[model samples]
Target chain A: MAKNYTKISIETSNDLKPKDETIDFLLNYSKALSVLKSAKVEFELVLN
Target chain B: MQEELITDATLVSSYIKGNESALEILIKRHKQKIYSFIYSKVYDKDVAEDIFQDTFIKVIRTLKKGNYNEEGKFLPWVMRISHNLVIDFFRKNNRLPKFDNSGEFSIFSVLSDTSLNAENSIIKEQVEYDVRRLVDELPEDQKEVLLMRIYNDMSFKEISDKTGVSINTALGRMRYALINLRKIIDKHNIVLTN
Candidate 1:
């Protein structure tokens, strides 16, 4: 009996680009997180 | 200097230091590779997109909390995160990805390498663009079949039905498209590898 082997190549084309909406959503989400983090820091400073 | 030329490590640190746009630069720079990796695993654009978002969100939380200690191996570290999330996706759905070993989902050894730095990514994008341009030089019929098969992920039957051609004809066109693409690549001396 002989074993068979197959090789597959991965395509690195631009066709797999994520939608712009996804990128915008991520930017906004990160911005909101930073805002909340700063707000928390300011509140902590006030408490101190 | 342009922000795009900044190293991923610099961008990561900048983002941690409250520079929001640094993260945007990082994301835009590497989004295609990350998204393509996830899509290769899940084969669903929407799910891959969601996983991409979640991966970045985890990155943000980890960086904000000062937990990201990968020591400048930004892309591989992010790839590892996305890989784990893909595994988690399968685990949640009570399924397993292909190429599992002893009930552990592990593949894509290429993702562990640090070869995909900023320069390499830019070169890869250029190669992709060049390949697409060469594809456009193909005959209209062959290019149509090739795009349908590759980009659209359509089966030969589907392509034939869509293009009102027989399955054999569609397959022939796909084969010729590849042959001609190789010739075009050779003629242009374009190396299509990252």
Candidate 2:
């Protein structure tokens, strides 16, 4: 006789909350965008 | 002399042959995106600038040593080097993200007693759940690009190289991901922030 196996899987998204990692990423991304914008201006200035 | 028409590979080859201006033109051509990529990870202007300069220095050294092999994909190659350097910086500084598994670790846990009401906490938690679920609903390719762009701070070019797709395809996936996410948000009336 073949052995029987039972498998159970649980999916949980209800417990999700804003992670510090995501928050930090957003903050960093915003700052980086500003820095890049300023750098572009400075680069243009030097080129001119 | 149509200098602007020179390709990255040509500029790199010329630089390798001791034409210093070729390297300058190469740097000038790709510095903005490269700098932006670095800034996305470091988040500090001074630090990003330092890494940006260091990335070029390393690139120059590698090119001089005849180590850089990706001729046509010079920008993507350099961006990979920049990404590695950012990782190294984080490793050296011990600044990598950490997850606290303790039950007490939560956004609400940091709030004052007066502000830690159940209603507000539930709303915050729901918004986070909805946002994550929406992201999960995205197609695999789009989700991959979205996560890489957001979490890994990788540029589209880097995403393309990593995912083995054209840059345009990677960018298109990201665009579609955003559009789909927006549609989901609107359909669910998901409020992302208070």
Candidate 3:
């Protein structure tokens, strides 16, 4: 994470923001995405 | 501040190097633009949300595989992805009508307005049901953590207390649960959106 990271949210044309559910889902999914990538790196390290 | 000084290219590289929260900052910074782009194309909130999620999924996959080399052009690159996904949504629902080019005009495709109606909503429900069913296939501990966090809306500390584990352990289970769910989705080729 970058230092001094602040949560700056923006809304859409409908005058409504993206749902909290959607934002949470994306953040969680991104964390999971990085996990698999790191796991693969570990696997390759063991292979070599 | 510091975040504003950190460019998208820097965030992209941080995410590739396994800093997950960098991706979160990236998503939050541009979510409004991307979400609005999808919503403008689809004209439906649910459909726009689904496309937004799918766009990030594709972005994460590309970055994880070290295939994202667009230099500092992150916003445009992501906008192009979201645009393609909007097209995919239209293509999937046959919203974009195909005209008959064989001299005669075709009314069938025009009349085939298969937009989000009652029937489409039913299909969407079925897809959600199928996803929940797949969640059952995760390992016991991971499934428990996922159900508690997602379905029950419990915080990690609360989950840790209930599950008799450290907070870090609970978080790990949740992360592994999500990773396994993605693998299951891929193996079953389940398109989460209708």
Candidate 4:
């Protein structure tokens, strides 16, 4: 594999203060919207 | 997911009353997991996107027809639909589903079970590494079956249809794959006792 991240997990999201797995999850959730937006932009560019 | 629109059950209630924004908000909220679940299944970036869209279309149709029974498990319900569509995509294509990269669906997320014991973190990492290593070396048939059953959580029936195999054969493949995996673990002498 290109990355050995299978072995190392830095626990970036888990902390004593707070973390946003939920927000991170939402960012992922917004992926479809971003994809739709980009495809629309590309189509508009092509039309223009 | 409806992170914004689903401030509470009230929004879903409004959604049930025929609100478009509520539906869109809900979709945007859980889009990533739905997409990842499908992408993980079919192992195609493009197909994942297509199935993701279709899933929402089904959701829209379901909602419009007032067929949404509010069980409060919105994302899981949506994910189930996305999962089925991805499997259907695999069925139509007549090809074994392969992970786009052995590492494409990174173990980080899968291993991100928040309850991971810090003391056993190293051991956990080692086990994960070894498991992944063995999984990588598995034959294409075994690897795809393992991924679908374990990762995608698809039922055996779903797997049979997706892989174009009979149900008995699908079960048999999984059984043999596990047997082979056990041999590999024994050969390595890596002890992970439950």
TM-score of chain A of each: 0.44, 0.36, 0.39, 0.27
Stretches > 4 Å off in candidate 2: A1-48, B70-72, B99-113, B116-194
lDDT tens digits, residue span B67-128, model 4: 67787577778878887877687788756635454744554655556775876787888877
Per-residue CA lDDT of model 2 for B43-117, tens digit only, reads 676677767766776776667656679634998889898999999889897665545544445555565477648
Greater-TM-score candidate between 2 and 4: 2
Choose 2 or 3, whichever is better by lDDT. 3
Scored by lDDT, model 2 comes in at: 0.71
Rank by lDDT (best first): 1, 3, 2, 4
User: Which window of 10 residues has the lowest lDDT sum in candidate 4 chain B?
Assistant: B1-10
Our model 4 lands, by Cα RMSD against the true structure, at 27.4
Worst 10 residues of 1 chain B by lDDT: B102-111
Question: TM-scores for all candidates?
Answer: 0.50, 0.42, 0.49, 0.39
List DockQ for all candidates. Answer: 0.39, 0.02, 0.22, 0.02
Fold similarity of candidate 4's chain A to the true chain A, as a TM-score: 0.27
Q: Model 4: residues >4 Å from true position, as ranges?
A: A1-48, B1-8, B97-194
Q: Rank the candidates by DockQ, best first.
A: 1, 3, 4, 2
Q: B82-187 in candidate 1: lDDT tens per residue?
A: 9999999999987654665554555755346766899899998998898888888999999999999999999999998999999999999999999999888788
lDDT of 3 by residue, B1-194 (tens): 78888989988998888888898889888888888877777778888888888888888778877888765499999999999988888888877655665545577745777678997899999998997998899999999999999999999999999999999999999999999999999987888887
Between 3 and 4, whose TM-score is larger? 3
Evaluated with TM-score, which candidate comes out highest?
1
Model 4 pairs in collision? A29-B32
How much lDDT does each candidate structure score? 0.84, 0.71, 0.81, 0.65
Clash pairs (backbone) in predicted model 3: none
Error of 3 at B161 (Å): 87
Query: What is the C-alpha lDDT profile of model 3 across A1-48, one tens digit per residue?
Result: 779876443342444447878888877766654323454463211110
